[model samples]
Structures are given as C-alpha cells and as structure tokens.
Target: MKASYSEFVELGGQRYHVRRWGNPQAPTLFMLHGWMDISATFQFVVDALAREWNIIAPDWPGFGLSAWSPGGYSLLQYTTDLDRLLDHYSPHAAVPIVAHSMGANISNIYISARPQRVSHFVNIEGYAPVPEFFEGSLGQVVGRWLDHIAKPGQGRPYADYARLCERLQQSNKRLPPERAKFLASQLGVMGDDGLVHIAADPLTRFFAPISLHREQLIELWRGMSLPVLCIRGGRSFISKAFEHRQEDLQERIAALPQGREALLEDGTHNLHHEHPEQVAQLIEALLEQ
Candidate 1:
C-alpha cells in the first residue's frame, strides 16, 4: 500500500482535514466520499489503481476530522467549499473528480454551476435525491427542523474498536472484515475516556429543509459541459427510491452533454470498495475517453 498523509487546510474560516496519496506532480484526482464517510474510505480503491495520480480527498466539513459547520450544512455550501478547495490546489486548471453518494451530488451541481472547473467526473450510485423529499411541503420541512432543534445532537459511543468494526460490517454487508476494521479506524478515534465514536458532527444528522425540484436538478445535469460516467450498484439500496423511476434517472443522466452509465454485477452501494479493481478499470476507461 502506498503511504498516505493527512494535513489541515483552513478554508472559509473552517479547518478541513485532507488525506493525500501518490506523487504530487502527477495529475490531480479528487476523490470525494459519501455522507458520514471519511477520505480514507477510498483506501481500497486507491490501492487498486493501475497508474499514479495525486489523489486529494478531503473529509467534508462535519465529517471525519474536519471542523463542524457552525451555521449547519447546506448543499450550496458544499459546492462553494469544493470551489475554494480547487482554487487552493489547482488554481489555474480544471481537474477530474471521482465522487460517491452525497459527494457525487455535490460534484454534479458544482460542474454544472462551474463547468470550466472540472475536466470530467465519475459518479458512483448517486442517482438523484428522492423526489418525495424534494416535493415535501414547506410546513412539514420546518416542523422536522424545529424538532431537530428541540434536542441537542449527540454522537453514539462504542465500547471498542472491534465492536465498531462489527457495526460497520453489519451496516454494509458487502464490506469484508478487514476493510471494516480499516474504515472503523478511519471513521473514528479512541477517546481518552476509552470509547469509540464517529468523528462527524452530530448535527450532520439533521435533514435539509429544501431541495431542488426534479426538473431543476435535471437542468443542472443538462448543463454539464464535460463527459460523465455514472456507475450504479446492482444490489444497492441507494437507488431503491428510483426502482420504479429508472427511466427518469436514465433520462437525467442522458441529459449530460456527454454521459455514459454502467451497472456492475454483484456490486452494492459501496461498490468502489467491494470491487475496487473493477471500479478502477471503469475509471481508467473514462480517462482514456
């Protein structure tokens, strides 16, 4: 395994934790993680690469070792944060982005909003937000927010590292024991009090009060100026809400100025981790195109 290093970068008054691997002079590849996941979650995938890439993976605010957002998180904030991240790293050129889940969602919008900032993107199992949530009544949304504000958030503590690993495995059945153990270490640290807990801010559990409409999001997809490769996991529940709307999802994907979608056999939502070699091959193909 290649040695990776961790460092902090102050962005917009918040300190971000970034994980890096490979040669700094190599072409930059931004690897973005899903909700509740840290930059190190891409370890297996990064290790399976065939060529060198200066991999820059940041633990998004409120996740991993990054500082929490004092004003709470919004989707727009993620896009701007990424914009600043790129400015600080690749100040003069567009770079490739490989993102999963929530990270993919943010990248999709970012590329749409600022097409010149990205050369291409590979989105894994980040089909689209559930239509229901996007269509929810404003009153209901506010009620949920009020409820969240009524109680202070708290992180769940684990008795030991092994216990946390077991829980991680239970949550993602496709995750092997060794990978789970590795991810457990990446997700949290053992506190001096002798308990293990997730590094993400507890308030991250709060739901967003508003979301883009279905067509509004599709417009963003349509505006993408770069080629995009969308990967789906055959057995992942991430697309469960789109089970009956596969056509809509495909249409949205097709709206990309240049887009291609593929589904991997026997892969789950975390397919990048479960079959990093295969995922790496797909990414290589995208790069070739």
Candidate 2:
C-alpha cells in the first residue's frame, strides 16, 4: 500500500479529518466518499492510479474521525462544509473531483451553485433515490423524522475487530479478506465499554425530514457546465432500483450540458472498492479527455 497521512482542519466550526496521498507537488485530485464512509475508503483507488496525484479526501462530519455535529446532519450543512473545505485547500483554482454516492450528490449540487469551483466531475453511482421511495405526504415525512429523533437508536456493536471484518465481508461478498481487514480497522473503533462500534455517528442512520425534490435537483444538474462522467455499477442495488426507470436516470444525466454515462458490468455500489483498477482507469481516461 502507498503511504498516506492525515490532517485535521476546522470547517464549519468543527474539526474535519482529511487524508492525503501521493506527492503534494503533483496535480491535485479531490476524492469524496459516500454516506457513512470515511476518507480512508479511497485507499485502493489511490493505490491503483497509474500516475502521481495529490489526493485530498475528507471524512465528512459525523463520519470517520471528524467531529460529529450536535444537531445531526443536513444536505445544506454538508454543502457548506464542502465550500469551506475547498476554500481552505484550493482557494485560487478549480480542481477535478471524483465523488461517490452521497459525495457525488453533494458535488453535483455544489458544482451547480458554483461551477467555477470545479473543472471536472466523475460521479460514481450517485443518483437521487427513486420517486417510489419518497411516496408520502410532507407531514408523513416529518412525522417519520420526528419518530426517529424521539427514540434515538444506537448502532450494533461488534465483539471485536475480527467480527467487524466478518460483517464487512458478509455485506459485500466481493470484498476480499485483506481489504476487509483494512477497512474494519479504519471504520470500526473500540469503545470504552469493551465493544467495537462503527466510527460514524449513530444519528446518521436516521432518515432526514426534508423531502427530496427531484425536479429541483434536475434543475441544478441542468445548470452545471463542467464536464461530468457518471459511472454506474451494473449489479449495484442502485441499478436495480432504477431498472424500470432507466430512462429517468438517462434524462437526469441528459440535463447536464456536458454529461455522459458508463456502466461497469460486474461492479456493485462499492465498485471502487471491488475494482479499484477499473475505476482508476475510467477516472484517468476522463482526465485525459
């Protein structure tokens, strides 16, 4: 594995953990992990890159080693965090970004609002949840959010790191033992209670009260002028969710002025982890283009 280091910086009045890899003098690449994921999740992809890059990945607040937000998390807060992060790291120039899942969604919104801050975007399986998932009245949505917050739940604890590693492999069969071991070490932390808990804040598991406005998001996508390469894993659950709505997915991509899509047949939602080399190749190709 290539060497990497960690840095903590203040963003939105909270300490954020940032991971760096490769040469600092090389062209910079910003990587954003998905929901409940940490900056270290990009290790494999970083290792697979054919050329040197100054990679910057941050663990979003409430996940990994970053300070957790007292009031839980919101999309607006995340975008604000990203805005501050970019200002602190690359204030003078727009930089290329590779973001997965939630990170990609955030980047989509961020780029739309501030197109000058991003030169290119490689979106990995980051689409709004299908409409069916949001079928309900506004009050019902807020009620569900209220119910969750009223009875705050805790994450399941593991007996040890070995058990956590087993759980990780069970969730994703394609995850090899060695890589799973590494992820278990990074994603799980031993608690004082003599059990291991996921490094993320437990409140993140709750549903947000705000309803997803698909049309609004599409409008945002439409406004983006930078190049975007959307990569989807053929076997990912997200693909299954949109199987009947493939056209809707295509239409969303079409909304972008310069957007294209690619499908990786054997990959899953965590395709970057399962096939880092292929993911890296796609990213490098986009950069070359």
Candidate 3:
C-alpha cells in the first residue's frame, strides 16, 4: 500500500514531524495516535478512506520524530502544543479530528475546553484520563516524579528490526504481521550498537503529577455542541474500563448535541488498525453528515 511521507516543522519551540497524505488544499483531517505510537500508525486507516482529504498526522512532542520538551509531559503542555499546531495549520476554521488512546484523551479535554476549535471529533477507544483513573495521592505523585527524575532516561533497544516488529504484534493480537512490520520500520532506528531503538523519548515513560478532574471534563462535555462519533472495540480493555463507570460514561456521551457511538464486533483497542475499511466508511459518513 502507498503511504504518506514525513516532514518536520518547528512549533512551540520544539520540532514536530508530520506524516501527510492526499492534497494539501483538501479539507484537513487531523489524526492523533495513542501513547508510544507514531504518525505512521494511521497509514492503513488513511489508505482505507474513500474520500479525498488532507490528512495530517503529527508525532507528539517526544514521540516519533518530534523533539522532546525540556520539562516532562503534562496534559496542559500537550494541549497547549496542540493549540499552537492548530493555529499554524487551521487558523480560521474548525477542523475534524480523529484521535486514539492518549491522543483522544488530550483532544477530548481540548475540544471540551475550546469547543470552537473543532467541528467534529471521532474518539477511538479514548475518552478522558480523568482523576478517577489515578490511584495516587499528591504525595505518591511527587514521589514518582522524584524517582523518575533521579533515574537516567533510556530507550529500550531491540535485538533487531524483526524482533521489534514481533514484539509489537505480540502485544496487540489485533495487529497483523505486515502492519507490525510497517510500524517497526517507521518507529525503529538503529543505535550505535547496531540494536534497534524506538524513535521516541524515554522521558515519556514518566508519570504526570495529575490529570483533569472528572467533573471538569463533564463540564466541557456539557458545552461540546459539535458532532461526536465515539467508537469502541468490543474486545478492548478501554471498553471494559468505561463499563466500570457505565452510568457516567453514557451520561457524558448523551450530553453531546449530535453524539453517536459504534462498536466494531471483532475490534480491539486499535480498532482503526484492525478494521480500517470499516472505520473509513464510518468516517466518510461522519464527514458527510
């Protein structure tokens, strides 16, 4: 399959790498990948799309080919960087967004806080990283941060490129051998020792001190009047997590003025990767609507 090529751009005092497909003049569709995932992870989904679009997928700061923040990661920092990126790419109009996992979590908070920035949002297996998900108190959070800062950051090196691809497939049963190999090619780089290391900052493994309060996210949801399509993998752990708070999750989804939800019967957390054609069909319908 044909794939998008990458280019680097400086934003927010950091360099960001983006994978682009289709025509630049076409309507922009911003794609956000999950934690530890690079921009190229969306290649399959982009290929499956039936409509013409300018798909821009950027590697989050510290991930993929993007530069890392001098300071550690935080939701506010990530959201701020996203705002800067939008200001550069889609200044005048609200843009459509497709986000997965951590990317979805970041965009959810952003759109809710700045509803005027997004026209439509497709959240894939990511809702919000609300405080409810945190088991640590302020003291624990501080201790974790201290520990992380005290330790030297290091990326995990693989025995070889094939081993890296194999590891990816082993972790996600839904990921095919071919797709895993593609991702490995995009994400792995050769180290001086001839080992393959993931092309992302090791600092990303550090934990954030806090997350948005669940009530705050709910407030954003109340003001989110734009259309939303929330897709969940029937076999995804994220789906099960939401089920633990079914009443709250349903209420939030219900609050969207034009909200809808779907389930890929055989899908996992990486539904877009496993069922790109189906996801593309849904996206086409979403954009048309």
Candidate RMSDs in Å, in order, are 1.6, 1.4, 1.8
Displacement of residue 218 (Cα, Å) in model 1 is 1.1
Structure candidate 2, residue pairs in collision: none
Give the Cα RMSD of candidate 2: 1.4
Query: Where is model 2 poorest over a 10-residue stretch in terms of lDDT?
Result: 203-212
Candidate ranking under TM-score, highest first, comes to 2, 1, 3
Count backbone clashes in candidate 2: 0
Q: Per-residue lDDT tens digits of candidate 2, residues 1-289? A: 9899999998667899999999999998999999878999899999999999999999998899999876777666788999999999999999999999889878877887888999889999888755566558878877877776676677899999999999999999999999999999999999999999999887777647573477977898888888889999999988888889878888888998888988999999998889999999999988875
The sequence of per-residue lDDT tens digits that candidate 1 reaches over residues 1-289 is 6789999999888799999999999999999998888899898989988999999999999998888876677677899889989999999999999999889988877887888999989999876666564446788787777777567367788998899999988888888888888888888788888899888777777656665667977898888878799998877775666778878877887788889888886888898779888999888789776
Q: Write the number of the candidate with greater lDDT, choosing between 1 and 2.
A: 2
Off by over 4 Å in 3: 130-132
Looking at model 1, report the run of 10 residues with the lowest lDDT sum: 127-136
- What TM-score fits each model? 0.95, 0.96, 0.94
Candidate 1's error at 25, in angstroms? Answer: 0.6
In model 3, which range of ten residues has the least summed lDDT? 127-136
The candidate scoring highest on TM-score is 2
lDDT of 3 by residue, 234-283 (tens): 88786777766788877777877788889897898888778988888888
